[model samples]
Every structure is written in structure tokens, then in C-alpha cells.
Target: MTTGNDTARTTVVVVTWRGREHVTACLDAVAGQTRAHRILVVDNASDDGTAALLAAHPSRPAVTRLGTNLGYAGGLAAALPDVGTEFVAWLNDDAVPAPDWLALLEDALDKDQGAAAASARMETAGGEPISLGVTLTADGHGADTTDTGTETTGVFGFCGGAALLRTEALRRVGGVPAEFFCYYEDTDTSWRLRLGGWTVLPVPDARVVHRHGASSRPGSREFHRWNERNRLYMLIRCAPAGVAARECARFAALTAVLPLRRLAGRNLPPAWNFRTGLRVQVLTEVLTRLIPLTRQRRAITARAVVPRPVVWSSANPPR
Candidate 1:
């Protein structure tokens, strides 16, 4: 049941690591898309025969192989130069899209000219809905919504795993920040889109099922390290100077209070791991502030189409 309009509009880019099985499942789901999309599987040096699996799908979407692991940002960036469509949809190798996902995203962007990117409802493997977008609280925390069937405003950011970005908007933002090898790349890019006067929308009609934590080992060192470091990096790179300072204060307070909260629950090992990771993140930020912060400041100040007040207020409110 291939739809007639599938060939011309969208290009789907899937980035994969060492998840050959998951990548195969993801590609099968993409092959089931109703609205026809050009597919590109960017293999990030998977040792698990990922390239061979992609090669087997020659009759479907095209495949691009990177000789080395470039991480999420690098893999997607490598695919950008070859994308020749109106919309580019990013799908993680460990996620499977619903049959109508492409159609739904296309419909949302078609109706809103200002939409720079649109995301579908992301669900867990067991069908529990994941919060793909949310409104930001004053302290940089997000309020998740359960109304998974309605269009919403004020979607602060989206997961790169399952989102459709306007080609022109992506071009304007100058593509994903390759400096961010993995985590928070989506947040950084989304903020840049908003600052450039483009809107990011979340379309509930579209959906994808993600196998959470499949790519990384649970409670592993790399998992904790990258998550903490990238979280801080994203906050620093995206927020205005005053807002960034406020967020840093809020985050520090939260970290200091975590041990007290954990006293009632989880064991000491995870707690100690978290505290150590936080310390490492803080030290890394202090050591590298001169270079990354200077670059971030230049980027934000140069193309600031939106007012600082709007950006700041959007992030913070009277509590």
C-alpha cells in the first residue's frame, strides 16, 4: 500500500550505532510510511553488522556509512550535505515509527508556515507515551503533558530521534552543532531555531516507539558522564547570559538537595555516582569556559532575532 505522494517530499535520516537488530526494525517501519519518504541510514561505525543489514535493504532507502563513530551530531551532519528534500525527518536506529508518522508531520508543517520543526508523539516500547515536548518552568525543568492527542503551543524542545525539521530552517541554524557529540544537540539546535524567529511544533497525530536506553548500558559510566556534561553544555550554549546564570544557580541548588532527597529511597552507590558526575561536569565547565562559552556568546548575540526578555521570560516565570 505505498502512497503515491511518498517519493517527492521528505528525506528520512536514521543514525545508528551498535544496534543492528533495532536498526533493522526501524528501517522496516520507515518502509511502511504512507507518505513516501527518501530514507538514509547513517551507520556510525557499528561493529554489529549494521552496515550489512543496511546493505540488504538496497531495495528500500539509501544507506550512508561513516567509517568511524561520529556520534549523533556527526552522523546527522554528514547526511545533511546530501539531503535534497523539503523536509528532513530524523529517526534514531532504536526507534520505530508508526505507519503514518511522515504524513502527520508533513500535515502539521503544511498548515503552519512558521513551523521550523515538528515532532510526533514518542512512546516507549510497551506503548507508554513519552514526553517529546514540554513547556519550560522558571527553573529549567519541564512540565510533561498527558494529553497526547492535541496540538500544543510552547513546545520548548524535541528529541532528535523522531522529529521533522524544515530544510530551510535547518540551513538557517547552520545544522546541528557538531561540537556536541551526543546528548542535548537537539536542544541546542531547537533554541537556535526559535531565536531565528521560527516556531517548533509538536504534532500528536504522528507517533514513534523508542526502545529507551537501548544504545547505552544502563547505569554505565559513559551514560552518566555524557548526560551530565551535555546537559550543562546545552544550558550554557542555548540560554541568554542572565538566563544561563540563573539556570546554573538553580541546577546547583537542585544537585545539592538531591542527596537529602535520596536518603529516603535509592541506595548510596547511584547517589555517589550522581554526585561525582555532577562534580566532574562542574569542573569541566570551569576549565573549558573560555572557549565554548565565547563561541556560544558570539553565536547567540549575532543572530538574535527574538528579544532577550521573551527568551528569558519563556524560560522563567514568577514562582
Candidate 2:
């Protein structure tokens, strides 16, 4: 199959799972880019006819259909090897970008030689801003800069949903952390990029309207489990030791007091028990992986070009 954009230097990778209703429109918007970029669709084992639809697209995007759902992190990991382009843009199946989305982000990277990634301004369908970029909290959590009410000028991280990244930079950072399965992977990568002396920039003019959580509902138990577990895991792999330790201890304290709070009627019993059980699972998983996680921490520390304090301070400038 002729994977269109033969002369283009960038490929937009859209990862989808059971998103038949959204994938077509997503691909159509990408194929309509004002910039001459290629389209590559990574179908994460979607059983909802998404793969077939991609195969039949007039744009004839290169499609990789995996046998099992590997989530967004794994899909990107699998597709990276075939990117061949100098840059790769990641777009969610539920997002539709303006015609110049890629062009503007490409211009941002072109203008900023030191930047390894550029985040596009993403808004909800109703035009409310969702994220221009991500900012790191002291406790190892990454929040949208828009949500933090902070300056959006130079963000520390880019949202995985709509962003452009240098292909070489991505490979240098050891690629996406497939172990994450989904959440916090981008923040973890951003941390690595900063530690490697690279910056993530925001391209406010490049915009996309995202139907947030279209594939995975935000409040579901699955979402909570992955979000919490991966947040801690990201801290272990990337955050400074002091921050990691403090956050881990805080998580433990929360887990310990949850049952008492449930008994006191501070938290609804059913929800409380479920929350407590998941926290136990997260703690157990982290404990079992401590040895490997520590080794990763050491490896990151050894290669880091920026000071830990500087990295943390950039995200948390004195207000």
C-alpha cells in the first residue's frame, strides 16, 4: 500500500481502541492538514470495525493492527520504529484538529531549536480550554497548566493527546514507557526530556478540539487505578528522590486512613472500600517492583544533564 505523504517529514499517529465512531472523523481531520504530513493509524486491537475502516480509508494511511489492546503508551511504542519521519505528532482518536494544526506546531519546533516537543492548545468541543501544556506539581503529579492557573508560556510537559515530538529526541529518551499502559507516560517522558537538557514548548496557535475521555471515562475505577498507580510509578522512574519519597509516604498515609474515614462516614462505605482496595493493590505493585524501579532511578540519575533542583524549580517557579 502507498503510505501517502512519501515526501513529507512528519507522521501523525492516531491510537484508537473500540472507537469506531470517532476514528474516521479523526483520520479525516488529520488527512486534511494544511501541512504535508503523513498519517499512521495504530489500531490497538479494536474489535469495533475500526481496523477495517482504517484499511479502507481513501487517504490510505499506514495502519498497524495489534492483536491485543496495549493502550496508548504501548501503541506509540510499537509505532515509533516505523515513524521514519523527522517528527511525529500524536493525536487522540477523539480529537479533531484545525487545518493548520500541524503547520503551527511544526513552526514552533522550527523556531525553537532547543525544544524537543511542542504541545498544541487543546480545547473541549464547547471551546473551553483544556490544556495548552502540562505542569508538574511538587508531589509528582502533572496537572494541565490551564487548570493550575499558572503562566502557560513555557510548560514543562506536553499532553500526549495532541503534541509534536522530535523523533530523535524520543528515541534518545528510550522511547515511551510502555510499562505505564496509559496515564502519566507523557509526564514521565517530559521529565526525562528535561533531565536530558531538552525543553517542551507550547504552540498556542495550533489547536485541537478534544472529546476528552471518549475512549476511557474519567471517573471509572479503571481510570482511577491506572492514574494513581502510574503517577507513583512515574515518580519512581523520574522524580527526584526526596519528592518521590514524600509522595510515596503520603500515598501510604492516605491508604492507611481510608478505612477509618469510611467507618466515620466521611466517605461513602462502598466507594471507600473500593478506593482502599485499589490503593492496597497500587502499594503492593510498587513494593514488588522496588528493586527494578530503584535501578531505573539510578540510570536516570546517571544520564541526567540538568540538576534535580533546577528541573523541579522550572515546574514550580516561586509565585
Query: What are the lDDT scores of the predictions, listed in order?
Result: 0.73, 0.85
lDDT per residue (tens digit) for residues 1-319 in model 1: 2112445588888888987767888888888888877877778888888778878873455767788988888888998888888998888888889999999999989999988888778888787887556455564543444454436444766667799999878987768777667766777777778778887788876889988778756466655555555655666766667766776676677667666767878555553346745655664664476476668757776876886567657656656
Q: State the weakest 10-residue window (summed lDDT) of model 2.
A: 144-153
- lDDT by residue for model 2 (131-202), tens: 988888867788886643323458889999999999999888778988788888889989999998999988
The residue-level lDDT of candidate 1 at 308 comes to: 55
Residue-level lDDT for 310 in candidate 2:
86
* CA lDDT, candidate 2, residue 272: 29
Model 1, residue 9: C-alpha shift (Å): 1.7
Candidate 2's C-alpha runs over 4 A off are 147-152, 268-274
Residue pairs in candidate 2 whose N, alpha carbon or C atoms collide under 3 angstroms: none
Which stretches of candidate 1 lie above 4 Å from their native place? 1-7, 141-150, 249-273
